[model samples]
Target: MITPAPNVPAIASTPTFTDTEIKPSQTIAANTTTPPTISETLTLPPVSVIATEVPPVKSTPKLANIEWLTKFRGIPGIGVNPVDAWLNETGTTSDPTCRDTRSPSCDKHYRDPLVDNWAAIRLTEVKIVFYKDELEKLITFSGVGSSISNWFHINRVLASSWTTLVGRTYGYFSLEGDAGNGQRFFTASPYQGCTKDRIFTLVITKQVASCAFDRHSSYPQFLFVTGDGWGYPENMTGIALADSFAILIK
Candidate 1:
């Protein structure tokens, strides 16, 4: 066995290595280029502000005082056509009895009172006379009462109503004289000729102080006539009278 071992190769042994020293990480400079400074500004379109001014609203004026001049007795007063006045008063145009266009006058009757009841009268008839142009030239109010006292009361009431309507006062000047202080008189006659009728007259002028001289000069006049007896034989005292009041505008 010893002669055979002399011709065999030798076996290699495991190698042992010694520990090496640890080294710290080294710092390296970075070559970084700051991105080219790209500054961009945004341009905006010009803004326009428009101011619109609103107009102020206009206010209407008040007409409380002079409103009655245009409207009275639930109808329009003088200068209006009789047909139109009738239509307005009755709210009808089909009433043939009220007016006839062929005639120069229109007659209307009222069964009820048109004014305050305490005034002791009722408007029974209204006769409107027109010119060729169909405009009213004269309007007459015919009323009948139970006694003479009622007649007098109604006359006084009509005078008061006129005073309120025209905003004037009664004066005491003669018919030939001037109406001083812008006031005029109401002329009344208890006996007018053989007719034995009571009559009342008032003349209104455009100028307040010129009534007497301006009576027939295109001014409006009011005349009232009333009586019970036809002739001189009958007694007129304490009797019912037919009152006819007329408004004349020339």
Candidate 2:
């Protein structure tokens, strides 16, 4: 037998794996590339509300000459009397008649109705303001505080009953105090709003003798005159539309 060289091939053939030689797959390779980062944006809506209105608060203001004073609305229907025509050249308007001619009551040491009932209680301050052409002129008791002791005004007749000086008649003002305490009276310069060439002024009285006047004897506490087409208790010519007065009780 030739033995064919025992069949030893010139080159040995490499061994190949059969189906039995293979094992099941084990580890899995992870993906390396990161996913492209995604960028996101958000949005929203709006809202609203409501409210009410309120008035302004004002403090007591200081008074000054030609200073901007506040508008004062005094007791309405009160008339401002024209003082110029009533008072004579000597500043004498009232006489012994004491009723018709009672411009400045020529009595001293008069009894105050407020003082008689309440001894310590007296009007501590008084404020007077005149309005014309939408402008204000203010005067206070403190302005003329010095010479006043117990000063007040009185009306002799009803405003409607007074035939003379229909719109210019303001009742009498009594200024009773020690001799020359201070500026006893004030004069309001003439303004061209009234019926006549009337210069307005404040009325104050002086003590001539011991003559004392009691307020209980009078019927009307004050008089009102009609001016600028208004009357007392009903007419507010200067007072309602223009003028005003106020008082501070201490």
**Between which residue pairs do clashes occur in model 2?**
94-101, 147-181, 147-182, 175-205, 231-235, 238-243
Tens-digit per-residue lDDT, 1-250, candidate 1: 5656565676778554435533222112222434444343554444532222445578775532222211111111222222222223443233333233333323332212223242353333322222223322322333344221122222333222123222223222122222432212233234233234322333333334422322333323322222221212123232221121222110
Give residue 169's lDDT in candidate 1 (0 to 100): 32
- For model 1, what is the alpha-carbon lDDT of residue 124? 36
Off by over 4 Å in 2: 1-74, 78-118, 131-135, 142-198, 201-243
* lDDT to native, each model: 0.28, 0.29
lDDT string for model 2 (196-246, tens) is 322222222222322121011321112223243323222223422333222
Candidate 2 residue 12 Cα shift, in angstroms, is 99
Candidate 1 weakest lDDT stretch, 10 residues? 67-76
Cα-based TM-score, every candidate: 0.20, 0.21
Task: Give the Cα error of residue 134 in candidate 2, in Å.
Answer: 7.1
lDDT of 1 at 136: 29
